[model samples]
Target: MIRIAVIGQSGSIPEEVERMAEEAGAEVARRGAVLLTGGGSGVMEHASKGAKEAGGLVIGILAGDRTDVANDYLDVPITTGLGFDFRSLILVHSCDALIMIRGGNGTLGELSAAYMNCKPTVAIETSGGWAEKVKQTAFEGCYLDERRTVEIHYAHSGKLAVDRAFELLASKWNEERNTGVTGD
Candidate 1:
């Protein structure tokens, strides 16, 4: 199944931002994709909540060894003992695509990792935080830097962001298939 990770802050997010995160999770579930998260509160908790409500599998890539610290909605808890930064890389590598919501420094690092790994990422611009700031800071409004590793897509809502991510994944798959490349 397509695994989609939702990266965002770990603190108290605004109600509207929470709704967006939940909607993104719900949409991911509705589309028959698994939900992956950092396994903390705020965006992670809400996304897990939505995915569970929609009968979707939810995986939490946790930073520490305590599975109890993860949100209750997780179907599986991957306790990496890698701490936040390193575990973040595992999360990036494990998913087919990512949806970035309102985030802080950690989210910024994940965005950079996604770009470096050439993973498709969609930022919900209306959710504030890094998701909104990235558009203004990115090169040509899509690339994260001069390297231009990959272009990031922007959406106004959670549903749209998830949709765009899937579109990106499909486009990449089609490109590889058309080129007759077996692996990318």
Candidate 2:
């Protein structure tokens, strides 16, 4: 099964952004993919809620060993005990693809990690934060650097972002297969 991580801002967020994250999580569930997040509040909580409501498995890659700090919607809490930055890396590495909503510095770091690892990522362009800013700041408008490792796809809504992530994942897998890269 595909594992899609939703990377975004924690703490207070706009209502519209919350809705977008929730919809994205629901769409991931509907498509039979597992939803992964930082396991905090704001975007993570909203997305987890949507995934749970849609009967999807939600995994939270928490920062500490305490499950109490994680959002209430998590079906499984992976207490990394590695703190936020390291835990974020685990979250990025474990997922096959990512959907970025309105994000802050942490989300930007996640995006960078995704690009470095060549993970398929779809950003909600209208959700604000790094999701919106990355389009203009990225090299040639998609890559994180001159390497052009992976093209970050952009969508206006959560559903579309999830759809694009799936498409990108499919294409990546096909390419890997055609190139004899087994990806094992």
Q: How do the predictions measure up, each by TM-score?
A: 0.97, 0.98
User: Taking the tens digit of each residue's C-alpha lDDT, what string does model 1 give over 1-184?
Assistant: 9999999988899999999999999999999999999999999999889989998999999999999999888999999999999999999999999999999999999999999999999999888999999999899999988988899999988899999999999989999999998445
Candidate 2 lDDT tens digits, 1-184: 9999999999999999999999999999999999999999999999999999999999999999999999999999999999999999999999999999989999999999998888889999999999999999988889888978889989999999999999888888898889998654
Candidate 2, which segments miss by more than 4 Å at Cα?
A: none
TM-score of model 2 vs. true structure? 0.98
> Cα RMSD to native, each candidate?
0.9, 0.8
lDDT, candidate 2, equals: 0.94
Candidate 1 residue pairs that clash: none
Give the alpha-carbon lDDT of every model: 0.94, 0.94
